[model samples]
Target: MHMDIEKLVESGSIVNELDYERAMVADRKLRLLAKTNTHFKHLRNKLRNLIVEYEKRVWSNEDAVDAELLAQSDRAQLIIEKERMFLEKRKKIIQARLKDFSLTQAELGLLLGHKSKTHMSELINGIKPFTLQDLVIISKIFKLDIDSLVPKYLSIEKIDRISAVIEEINNPKLSKIKPTLLSAS
Candidate 1:
């Protein structure tokens, strides 16, 4: 059943009302999940700060810190790098969407309440991480229905769960079990 729904979504089919509803629900779930993962964004910023602090400490007194601390700092830096890469991909998607709407950086900056295009470029280049408020403003400006500006990174298990939910909702047996109306004569 999960596979069927996945196949349907992948095939881009709108066979019936159930299929359409399932697709809509899945998309909504994805958007909600993306929004809920705001913690990751915060965590990335915290990690970046820790990395900088650790680097400064090591530089100030290399002999005081042990190898383990250095190794841990390296790990934190690696995680921050990976998160930046993920954000870069999301930025590209947002840029593509902006292009689709024929929007320029200057225009987007104005819409987002920025002073100039340079600020928008910084956000686009991943120099400045986007806050949730930024995403909301972009969504409003572009008339985006879902959190399409932020990329949804779903795990395999998450995909399976979503597919299962879609299948269960669209199951024919469930659809056939309609409530009967009682008529008073």
Candidate 2:
């Protein structure tokens, strides 16, 4: 199994507890065939790194964190953590509903336009993101709000970006929607 290294490193990268378990399972499977399998080793290592990064972010002072003070890479990792936290909530809801509705992963996967159950698993587990359209489809079919499918949270970078753009636009009407823009704040 090949890991998307570039994706794993990007701000968009998704790594979660399930991804770690999958990596460990893959590592074990690969090791049984070849102890020194480079591909599995690399994939496992990257997943470990991401999990470590996420775990380190849970400081007691999290509320005091300011985006401006973080280095670019730290900011990116913060985004990863934020995304993972929000996705975990949606994942829990979806998984429970799947069983309640007597639905198989493959069936839901197909509905989400994912022909491969593994890919669907990735999306479900937060190892990969679900597209907005995919989430909307799930919401419609499952009688869930799109917000419930993805409760709102903004990464620090996005918050800063919106703040900057609003400042640049200099539109007084933008002030009316400021609360919506920084909902997480």
Local distance difference test values of all predictions, in order: 0.50, 0.60
CA RMSD of each candidate after superposition: 19.3, 8.6
Model 1: lDDT equals 0.50
* CA shift of 73, model 1, Å: 1.5
Candidate 1's residue-wise lDDT over 44-97, tens digit each? Answer: 344344434434545458686778655544543433444345655667777887
lDDT of 2 at 164: 82
lDDT of 2 by residue, 1-185 (tens): 12333365444334543333333433343343234445445555665566556545532266745564345445445444555556667888898889988998789998888898656765775555678799899998888877777646665546668878888898999856656753443
| Consecutive 10-residue window with the lowest summed lDDT within model 2 | 17-26
C-alpha TM-scores of all predictions: 0.44, 0.57
Candidate 2, superposed: residue stretches over 4 Å from native: 1-6, 9-42, 47-82, 169-182
- Write down the TM-score for model 1: 0.44
Model 1 CA lDDT for position 153: 41
Worst 10 residues of 1 by lDDT: 176-185
